[model samples]
Structures are given as C-alpha cells and as structure tokens.
Target: MKPIELMRAEAVNLTEDPDEVCGYWRGHLVWVKQEDADGLWYVRVNHPDGGYLYDGFWRAHRDCTAADAVAEAFRGAELLEDE
Candidate 1:
C-alpha cells in the first residue's frame, strides 16, 4: 500500500470566498467554494501531462487546523467526486 500524498498551499483572504484567493489552484477556472473563514486554502494536483487538476474545495475553521481538515475532506470526497 502506498501512503497518500497531499500538496498543501495557502492564500490570503482577498474576499470572504475561499475560491477567490485559491482560484490559482483551479488553474483560474474558479474552484467551488468549500469554506471561507480567516484565510483561504486550496488543493491542486498535477495531471498526467503536467497540467493542473482541480480536486475540490476545503473549509477551514479558526479553531482547527486547515491542513488536516482539508486533507481529510479531500480523501473523503475523492470517491464521491469520481462517482
């Protein structure tokens, strides 16, 4: 079994929308707004051809760590998104 790998990145709160600041993660396609609070976070993976592939959105709370929540959310949402 291979361990799951995640690419973590951060962005500022230009607005209240997580997708706006993290828009770069979606290759500027505008990722779906997952959650917005203090800062913005996004997940983008490289495609087979080296292009960016938008995974989804992640909502972070001030009380919790965004990285952990984002990773867990992505892992859980991966299968649902594929279906």
Candidate 2:
C-alpha cells in the first residue's frame, strides 16, 4: 500500500483505541502503548528484527484529540530511507 493509505489506516486504528498500534512508520514496524504518566502516550519504533529503537512522546495531550497524538508520534518516527 501507498504511504497515504498507510497513514489513514493507522490514524483510524489510533482513533479507535489510542493505545492500539499494529502499524508502521515508513517501513519500520511500530506500536502505540500507554505510559505511566497521565495522558502520556508512547510510540514504540523497532528494528525489523524486533530490536528496540526509541521512545516517542508528546505532552500536548492537554488539548489534543486521539488523531493528534498519533500524528505527534508519527512526527517523532525516524524515516529510514537513504538519501
């Protein structure tokens, strides 16, 4: 599927459940999980081999929608394509 299609699909899934993330960023496998902090969300990026990448978070949940949080996580995702 195209990137836009992926984005829309991911966004829909996120909207359904902010903590559900069976999605991808670029070609990287990703998942959205909840953090211990209130309103804190985590986008878990990982290696194709199932290794750890980094945590992605945004504290602006104060005035944001579920889609907003997913978008924020997308912003923090690393694009792995080469130049």
* Predicted model with the maximum TM-score: 2
- Give the TM-scores of the predictions, in the order they appear: 0.30, 0.50
lDDT of 1: 0.37
Query: Which is the leading candidate under lDDT?
Result: 2
Expressed as tens digits, the lDDT of each residue in 13-73 for candidate 2 is: 3324554454655455656655644666666666667776656665665445455655555
Global local distance difference test of model 2: 0.53
lDDT, candidate 2, at 64: 51
Candidate 2 clashing pairs, residues 3+ apart or interchain: none
Clashes of 1: 0
As a whole number from 0 to 100, the lDDT of residue 6 in candidate 1 is 23
